[model samples]
Target: MLTKEFDKPLQILDQDGQVVGPLPPNLAPDRLLEWYRMMWLTRFLSNKLVALQRQGRATTWIPSNGQEATAVGLATPLLEQDWLTASPREMGGYLQKGVSPAAVAYFCRGYPPPPELVGKDARCLPFTIVIGTQTLHSVGLAMAAKMRNENSVVVGTCGDGATSEGDFSEALNFAGVYHAPLVMVVVNNGWAISVPSHKQYAAKHLAMRGIGFGLPARLVDGNDILAVHAVMEEAVANARAGGGPTLVECVTHRQAAHSTSDDPTRYCPPENLALWETRDPLKRFRRFLYDGGYLDEKADKALTLEIEAYMNEEVQRAYDYPAPAPESFFDKVYAEPTPRLARQREEVRQETGAKR
Candidate 1:
């Protein structure tokens, strides 16, 4: 039942970082720097987190490493009040959306995620570790926007593997039927754990899935930050104008393992890694910056130092902050603790007393 109007994918930039079409006048030098800064900040945090995991400082870790473009580009076009629901690998989007460095570090360290993550107080949403479950959350948020007649749109993000989940399909169906103001962005990194993308789904392209649900869809080379920003701008503008939902599938590569516990060597070859390295999102963006005279060798060096210092500060802050007390678990689980939870809390208290 979907319209076939969107035949060719939308893109504003080529793989070499040149714009395929006109750059939006509004995104002139000053505004473009904002996007670059966000991406740099996220990349800095991602590298630090990987080090933290390796050093055993972090218990839970999911690094966005090479996928910086997809997150930052999509987030740049969103309003400050719009909602964002993301998978674990999308800490970059939170950074781009203005989540504080300390809060992100705390959450990734498993030391009580920030409150802003769960509430509308901040545009960011707490990540759903259960894969594609947040698709329904996005649908629900969009549905709420519709009921309230608000201009707010909900942008949900997921990995390629998430598309394999039933919740993803159901969310799209419901959102499409109601013409909800939602944008589903799939960061298809071509690998879902040890399984290659081909093994995970039979579809030729993830973007095509939107057609079945009656939604507008497009594919983009995720490494091209300019293209990502442009497409997201168009998509977000459409949704806010009450044009309903759009599905964007960004074809990028995962430069790291599924998690700290995963090893890509089990399935990926050395040449495959090398191929993606040449297409590193950061390098591509840097090329664009250099070619446009937006950055010089001195500026690049200074920026690198700045990012390193910032990340070191975040690491220190995370370590200095105290971990949440055992009671925090009890408090977060329910508004009013049930009798069973109350009893369990008492038991834990008793056990601690006995040990002391």
Candidate 2:
């Protein structure tokens, strides 16, 4: 029987969507339905983003198709005041923190989020494209919060590939030494772009790395939202209570090409691909909701269609936003441009022949 000991990767729901262990606190049927909707929205919107790339409307996008549960579960337990610092493929976290779908659409099209919608609106950080860098950023933020005696806890996430980065190691080391109020989550999808994880490390589970740094750690089923959410709640609570940083390794799979620019079929293992398809997080969660009488076919279809229609409208709105100017990159560097940046900005403007 499954137990709270969590000696193995925790799994609350099995392949058939049957509960195999205890549910998390306050997991009412309504909340479960809400969680399912978020997962669906993430996958549905993410698939449309992939299409945007194919149609040449977007430069490229990171697809989070098979990893919905980890993204959603990782963000669910976080308070409005807590921080969510993430690398890309975390659409669910953005939406969970009340990010506008239109803003996400705008960002995916290579534009900054309209400046008005950030700051007080959400504690979530802008998407970081450079792998593993967000880990350090979050750790630094948490250390600052600790110094100021604030209650915020920072949650940082990265792909399995980031574990090899010097930044990842340094961030973990710093957090451990300082006991920063941070939680680091590794969305271990078993492959780093074209490279399988076995080639990256000899350790069986990435969670063990945390133990090496004197932080609590757990390996959880990333597809099992119940398990993921519960584990994240404990980690977040631990950090908030001054217990220091905790590391969680969520084992999931990337269902699509790493990004619109890469091709997975060239190297992804066929047998493993077939296996993970059956473990699709959205399907599994939807089935759990159905079995528990929280959802019916008609209700599911209606909600999904509503979201689908809204997605198109929002994406179109994103496309309608004026394209970014060539020199706009220098605009946000500081409250006022540094003298050197002002000169460089002027040079770019002259080269582009952009009218003043």
Candidate 3:
């Protein structure tokens, strides 16, 4: 019912910081400030990662520049016992779920994250780089929770491009059939690499796809922190109450290149980028806080400086950490190395003068 009425991206706060729709209930001023800080922190970390990549201290950094609110909003509401399976670009979710900044930096450097940073007991999985595969992982985890009578939900996130993958469809069908406690979040950031949404699917909104699977679906303004948090809170609550999975399409823009390896100038026009700039999530939320008298210029400057110092310490620590041994890759492939693989490993060790 709500999904049908608000099929377009739902927005409570307009870009100018005025309420255009009814605000979500019980969102106190303190909670709003917390959400703002989370968004700001996510953006700050993303920007710093981009800089680290450009400086050659990090590798394959995926920019979550314009999607911080989507990441933080969807994740912040989840209970600590709940699990999250997210795409590589969902750094805000990872951080909110207790993944440390140093671990994120380690991830950017292509190194294995430390145990604590990898969410060993935090119920967060490593960032899923294989796109829609995490959808199935989320379904399986939720199914397991249901079997164990655990009151936890699995929140799976993927890009809109992933919706086209067979894995996404299969996971949705299974989750629907089993009535699993899961929340599937599709971040529709306009472009899936070089392909735009128009080329990705024929549906007016990706949320419609969940209708056939008998799941409640809604589209939320990914750029609006309050609206995103409100929608996701409802979705998570429903799943926890045994109402089955909910598909949420977060409509936002990809304000940066797909990754450090991408050249957006080849496909993304200047006009398109210029337009989304006006709807920038951080700016919109900051304006909202300012207008409400929750945040002032002095506080904003102080917060920025604090976040900068925190990131500087974490980034330097990550840089100083030792790189993983190249030979360890060979060790983990099998219980017992095959003769040919053993010979190859020895050859590499000999070539690199690496000790066992």
Candidate 4:
């Protein structure tokens, strides 16, 4: 029987990889391998990104080292028509949403993103590097959907530290009061750069903030892919059915520090390292697959080789990408540049002694 706790937060698998309850009813056995592949691909992609940053191919990168399950699982329930607003660590979500591997890797380069990823027909928004702005964008999208009588639900993801921002609160409050069909997913990976959660919020649980907005909210085991998917699927359903906003707090770990520039050892203790390792999502999920007879040593070895080959191809493609043209910056600013911006653009060109 499913634990009552599992109903509210809904964890499908325990740390030891034992099924805590029945699998998601709609999920087919044939599809489980696909989800596992996406999760593994996320890990492989993240490893490549870190290497790219180290080799100076990309300017900055926030490694989603421990965040694959949280991103990939929650993304599984999203229909192609549903909108998704994501923070920077959304490569996993993008991949699930049909973003190509080459497109994902090339975007991080100091160049225009490949046409496949950022084309006019793509559903995803450009990644928001600013902390909490995507919350407002998500709220706006939900509001527009409501106006259009569109039944699609929208999801916005942010870091745990983003909750401290006023924009995050305002977005939730507005979303609740308006009963906007949106899901606010907070991936609490335990640190915002040098600051830990203890220093960031006084509340015991981040999901409790949804109460203030008079919306349904709950926390979940972020590392458990099945658990995160089950809960987020329900949350998405509720939103699409016009039950209004839901706040989902996903408790996961960063495993690595904040980004390429960060050094977690400066703040976190070695014991903290040992603790999270025991709860490693990849290890835990692998065991779940093994116990269920869905995976074996042969499958694992072949999958590793497959992913490694893909990563190597992506790294080479990223290396060959051309630098963005100087004029490309001015192109995305607006439909038509304002007079001040036009003047500033010319001024910058003149100052840099560049061709018109």
Candidate 5:
């Protein structure tokens, strides 16, 4: 049986980005570069989305500003067939899992998700706006996968605040009892909205909750991409091997506000935020690449320009797309609309002067 590691958070990179612990044996320089690119892309996209939101092109968005390491690391190891149920802040994971920037942009604007995000073959569920609900969906998916004797593992990610929800507890109980092939990742970014972690739970570490459910658990340095990837890889492997669920608590900080609607300065102290800035995952990882000679100023500048150009084009396309038709709301809810819904649909059609 896999055991819980209740010690300090696992970390492979120091704040200086130098390897402070043993590196993963399988990680190569090229793979590290790829990981760096993904993290950079995720960060850039998140920043751009926030900018778009400010400019009224996008709706409220959860910025994954400081959590790129945790997002990309956890996602990089998953196979194409593996399923992911993620929160809004996990746009990094979504992008890493082959989700398109255009699709994400459209979704953020309250439009229908791009076709790429729909259907079973997408291998990723839409972002769960409701806290802790995705855990149940992940458990259900894992249970079904186990029933079919498939090797696929279902991963569910949520923030620290989600752990307090009843659905989270129930899902953990079900996953434990059935030994479902699920991995629950808690991105413990110290705040569940405006509430800090100290007030959210009494436990010293959230990973302890998983131990109570009879599953292996680990506390990981969410800023250390290598550590996050290493820990998740083991958890995924164990789940695929039929060892059951594991809960990984990624300890990081939400550098940005909870969403575009929130104001973190109202609750979070500036000093605390500044302290975390010193450990910014992107900055740390960039230093590592530079020190290793994998990235230089010229290459970094070129990559930044390339990604920015791509993002600008995609954002413009999303902005140019027509708004959702009024009729579309009444459609897709059912194969055949109910009597009341059918009447409402006609009312919308008449009100909007939309035909067919």
Candidate 6:
């Protein structure tokens, strides 16, 4: 149920990097550089994480190649006090929230990864493996904030595929009823694994789903960082002002496989991937900066080198952390081991000699 006026996604910059709308909010002289840096770091982090998976250092990893704008823009506007429930591919959010690239790389190496503490006091949750579960967690955090009379707003992010989950619906319903200070960002990347978005729902945008739950829904060009940042700023402000939850649908495309285990070439069309390539978020933003004379060739090349060296250090640091012990799960599940847990621990010890 999208109104005719809202049918089209909002755009602040065209694919060629020309401004197509008013200037995005928070446009300080250095803000553009900061935004581009975060996006670049995210892409590099993704490549490194995916490489780890392929190198047998990690089992699988999510990539955020095409959705850089959606991840960074939405996360950039958030304050340190605010909470963010992360989606698997929002590596930009993790980096922006003060979680080190090394910590992130290390997290991927652990089987099943760590939960919640992945970001610690940074207020960023670990990358969620269960699709829409973070939505509920966000609402709960918002409610707790309200109860404590704290002004912290909570942001929960998810993919279009997660909008179909019952937990998402429930989260929306509860947030609406309580007027929780929350922002819900749904990135419609056109495919849920091999399933095309056309088969997911009849609604023109996933934001429409929030409308039914009493949330204000907005659609933005996910590939355009300006548009994504502007819309996110507005939504976050609204929620912080006690205006209730707002849902934003970021229209983007997943340019690569869903994960290291996925092969999009088998099910996704080449034409579609090629089309999105022309709309790469980082490319468009970089072009805009160059056109505006905000970024010179020297600065651009320097930043590229800086990011490469920075990420290399991060990857090396990630390697410094030892892998989890095989029997760590049993010993760390609780302070005192129960009889059943002891038995399980003994069984694992007997089988693998996992001593520590």
- Please give the distance, in angstroms, between residue 109's alpha carbon in candidate 6 and its true position after superposition: 0.8
Q: Which sections of candidate 4 miss by over 4 Å?
A: 1-9, 117-122, 343-356
Compared with the true structure, the alpha-carbon lDDT of candidate 5 equals: 0.86
Residue 160 displacement in candidate 5 (angstroms): 0.7
Please, what are the lDDT tens digits per residue for candidate 4 over residues 1-356? 11123234557788788888668886676677778888888888887888888988776878878788898877888987888888758678877877766776776774557675444444667788899999999999999999999878888888889999999999999998898989889988888888889999998888778878887887888889998888788889888887888888888888787788978888888887777677777888889888878889899889878987886786676667666655467767899999988888777767665553
Worst 10 residues of 1 by lDDT: 1-10
Which residues of candidate 5, in runs, are more than 4 Å off? 116-120, 352-356
| lDDT (Cα, tens digit) per residue for candidate 5, span 66-119 | 999999888878998899999879888877787777778888788666564333
Model 3 per-residue lDDT tens digits across residues 228-301:
99889999999998898999999988888999888998998889878668878988888888988889999989
Better of 2 and 5 by TM-score: 5
Candidate 3 Cα errors over 4 Å, as ranges: 116-120, 331-345, 354-356
Supply the global lDDT for candidate 3. Answer: 0.85
Q: What is the C-alpha RMSD of each candidate to the true structure, in Å?
A: 2.6, 2.5, 2.1, 2.9, 2.2, 2.6
Query: Please, what are the lDDT tens digits per residue for candidate 6 over residues 1-356?
Result: 22224668899899999999999655986888988998999998899889878889875788998888998888888888999997768878777777788778877876434444244567887678998999999999998998888888888988888888999899999999999999888888998888899998898778778768878889889999999988888888888887888988889989789988888889988888787679799889998999999998999999988997898798787776667767677866779999999998878877887454
User: Can you give the lDDT of residue 345 in candidate 5?
Assistant: 88
Of 1 and 3, the candidate ahead on TM-score is 3
lDDT tens string, model 2, 56-142?
887689998899999999988888788888866988987877787788888877768785533357777889998999999999999
CA displacement after TM-score superposition, residue 37 of candidate 5 (Å)? 1.4
Best by TM-score: 5
State which candidate, 2 or 3, has the greater lDDT: 2
